[model samples]
Target: MKIAIAGGTGLVGRALTALLHEQGHEVITLTRGKPKNARHVQWLNGTLPLEQLEGIEAFVNLAGVSLNDGRWTAEQKEAIYHSRMTATEEMLRIVTQLSTPPQVIVNASAVGIYPISTTATYSETSTQRAQDFLGKTVADWEQKASRAKELGIRTCLARFGVILDTEAGALPLIALPYKLFVGGTIGSGKQWLSWIHVHDVARAILHAIETPSLEGAINFAAPQAERMKSFGKTVGRVLNRPHWLPVPSFALQLALGEKSVLVLGGQHVVPDKLMATGFTFQFPTLDEALHDLYKS
Candidate 1:
């Protein structure tokens, strides 16, 4: 199989790219910068070398700015929105122009599209879309990515949860406080944290590509969703540290502005669509995922 990946340098993209290559698939990275290696192709301002579009079977667009980079100012929010929309639009445009466009298009989305709720459990079929900034961004992003279906291509929107990897994402920051023996829950510690191991994230993407029946919104999350308080205890247990300090809601809000919701708020997202299509998760439990990631 031949795959083209946008934003292959990101946290999730990097892992996905490596996994694809390990599985004997040819991986081509589409980047805005210079092609650093033979497998990399440069695409700028929605422009790409048309010759490279041939024979690509799968197109995965993970191109987007880091949401947790900093506080979500108006400028940063626009950048976040622009980066995702433009990169996805470029890939879709190239796909349309290709003589043999990819059979499947797997896009990166977020569970944040579901409203932040403790009591509500969301699945792919849920019609309730979030009206907040992050929710709207993900909803619009998925809408744009959905255009590939019009061209007779199978499209899968992998709505990611809190990706748990030791190298990057939220794990390190969450574990750092534990290492220092000051780790605890944030806010009321009751908010649901829909999380998945990074390995499962990569696997889920490949599953979506090969599974013909999967052609819509799929939550790439674990089977079990944990509350912040229990999540903290698991981290502490895994690292042999103490979970005994609470970071107040106001503190996070003051520090992260609106972006604090990414941590302070969460959703109980279930992978109903993914599981229905017969995709199994490598790390379905928070304890199993944390132990695997933190094990020496």
Candidate 2:
């Protein structure tokens, strides 16, 4: 299969691109900068390179500004929102112009669309949507991505959970305090965290691309959802550190403002769609994931 990936230089994009190459698929990366190699083609801020993207079989849209780049100021929030909307819109434009539209499109999404809850467990079927900043942003983002379906393209909105990785994403920062022996529960420690290993995240995206019956919102979370307290303990245990000190909610709120929800609040999300599609998670358990990332 020939796959075209927007934002293919990002964290998850990089992993997915590598996996696709390993599986013997030709990959083309849509980029904003100079083409790094034969596999990369510049898209935004220039004419669409129809010749370069011809015969692409699958499109994975992962272009977006990082939410963790800085505090969620009004300008920063606008950048976050517009970045995703613009990139996704560009992808749609490119696909519409293609002589042969891709068979499938896997657009990046986030589980933050689900309402933050400690008791309520959410799956792909859950209709409840969140109203917070991040929640609203994700909700709108997914809606825009869903436009691909109107073009008769099989669209899969991959609602990612907290992606754990050793060098990038959230794990390194989450494990920092643990490495210093100051790690502990943040806020009330009751917030549910729906997390998945970065490897599993990439694999799930590939699965979505290949599965014909899979469409709509698919939670890219692990089967097991852990609360912040237990997640902290696992981090401590894996790092051979102590989970003692506690970071207060006010502290995070003051530091992060509206963005503190990333840590101080969460939802219990499960990958029901992935499970039904017979997708197997390499690190289903948090312990296994942490150990593989830290202890391996």
Candidate 3:
């Protein structure tokens, strides 16, 4: 298979691209900058080299601004929303121009589309949509990607949870206080955290690309969702540190502003679609995931 990926330099994008390469698929990465090599193609400018995208079988879009980069100022919020919309619109435009559009498109999404709740358990089938900033952004993002389905292309909206990895994503920051022996629960500690290992995220995306029956929204979360308190203890246990000295909710809100929702609020998301499709998680439990990441 020939695959073209946008935002291939991102954490999840890099992992998925490597997996595709290891499986003997030819990969092309679309970048905003100069083409780094033969496998890299510059896009997102007014013009794209359509010839380079020829024979591409699958298109995976992970393009967007990093929400964790800074506090959510008005300008930063606009950037977050427009960045995703513009990139996805570009993807649709490119596909329409292709003589042979890719059979499948795996567009990135987020579990944040679901409302933040400690009691509510959300799955792909859940219809209750969140109306907050993160939720609205994700809802609009998925709506844009859904355009591919109207073009008769199989589109999979991968609603990712908190992706855990030792080097990138949320794991390092979550584990940092533990490393320093000042780790403890964040906020109320009762907020649910639906997380998946980075390895599993890549696997789930690949599974979506290959599975014919899989379509619509598919969650990329572990089977079990842990509360922040338990999550902290697991991290401490894995790192051989103490889980003490809790960080108050007000402190995070003051520091992160609206961005604090990333940690202080969460949803208990379950991978119902993935599980029903026979997709197995490599790290199904928080303990298993943390141990694998922290092991020396």
After superposition, candidate 2 runs with Cα above 4 Å error: none
TM-score of each: 0.98, 0.98, 0.99
Q: Please give, for residues 98-215, the per-residue lDDT of candidate 1 as tens digits.
A: 8899999999999999999989999889989889999999999999999999999999999999999888888898899999999998889999999999989999999999998998
TM-score of 3: 0.99
Full-model lDDT, candidate 3:
0.94
- The best candidate by lDDT is 3
Go through the candidates in order and give the clash count of each. Answer: 0, 0, 0
Which scores better on lDDT, 2 or 3? 3
**Candidate 3 lDDT over residue span 143-189, tens digit each:** 99999999999999999999998888788998999999999999999
RMSD of candidates 1 onward, in order? 1.0, 0.8, 0.8
Model 1, residue 87: C-alpha shift (Å): 0.7
Please provide, for model 2 over 1-296, each residue's C-alpha lDDT reduced to its tens digit, 9 standing for 90 to 100.
99999999988988999999999999999999999899999988858889989999999999999987899999999999999999999999999999999999999999999999989999888999999888999999999999999999999999999999887877787789999999999999999999999889889999998999999999999999999999999999989999999999999999889988998889999888999989999999999999888765
lDDT for each of the candidates?
0.91, 0.93, 0.94
